[model samples]
Target: MKYFVTVQATQADYEAMEGTESPGPPRWSREELLAMVNFMGELNNELAASGELLDAQGFTAPAEARFVTASPGTEPVITDRPYAAADVQPAGYWLLECVDLDRVTEIAARITQCPTPPGSPEHPVVIRPIGEAPAP
Candidate 1:
């Protein structure tokens, strides 16, 4: 079965940011960021070798977000401004074809080892099963 595993962050952290997007990258050193990137690459390689990795990627900064809200019998309200940072946002995700949820949970746990801002150790990952489409 296919699963979606993504890094999740709290609204509080985003609210504390100087910007809505990527937090400006000023929170970590270049070397530290490079190390995290390398670590992610290693994890992706492992998944690829296992033939479980369907896709893996990070989302663009939240600053580019667009909101479309429509009420009953009303035209949709569209806005390009960043949506509420109080809501949890996905930072990135890995799409994997795993045998079951247990394996997917393991993968998410491993992903927790990825470094975050200094003194902050609460970045979490969420995993959800991608169900099949309805038959025609």
Candidate 2:
């Protein structure tokens, strides 16, 4: 089965990574950031070798996000601003094809162990099964 494992973060988290002063956690040192990058690369390689990783991607900061809302007959409303920092946003995701829920859950557990600066919040890692599409 296929699953999407998502990692959440707040605006403050993004700011911390950028070495900016936001109401979030303390900034990450350059070495810490490099460690995180390396960690993720290693994890991805391991998953790919096992033929479990289908895809993975990280998102930009929430502040750079664009929002759009519309109804069938109404014009689309658009804005550049994102919700408040307290609201958690999806920071990245991994698409995986695993043997079963247990396997995917194991992968998610590993994802939750990804490196972060000390004292940083333990962000959530959500796993959702992908449903089959209806035949056209």
Candidate 3:
């Protein structure tokens, strides 16, 4: 089964991220970051060897992004940054094609160990199965 694991963040959490002008503190030491990446790489390699992981990538922060919104009978509004009502933003995500939910949960836990800004513990990695496409 294919699953999408979304890493969610609160508004305050989003605001606290490192921007281009002001890179924040390192969540992990250089060595630690390397180790984490290596670990994840190993996991991915293993999964690929077993023919499980379809694809995976670590995303850049949203500060380097644009936001767009649309409403009925109106032109789409494009903005420089994400617009949220005080409590919602997607921090990152991963797509995993696994054999079962148990495997997906294990992968999600591993991905959650990726670093985050200080003082934010509620940012959780959520995993959900992708449904089959509707018949024509």
* Tens digit of per-residue lDDT, candidate 3, span 22-87: 233323345654665677778778877877777776555455567779999899998878544244
TM-score of each: 0.77, 0.94, 0.68
Clashing pairs in 2: none
Clashing pairs in 3: none
Write model 2 residue lDDT over 56-108, tens digit each, in one string: 99999888899899999999999997678777899999999999999999888
Report, for every candidate in turn, its global Cα lDDT versus the true structure: 0.75, 0.89, 0.65
lDDT of 1 by residue, 23-134 (tens): 4323455576677788999999999999999999976656566789998999999998755544567878999999999999988889989865566537568888999999
Q: Candidate 1: lDDT over CA atoms?
A: 0.75
> Which ranges in model 3 have alpha carbons more than 4 Å from their true place?
8-27, 82-91, 113-122
Candidate 1 structure, TM-score to reference:
0.77
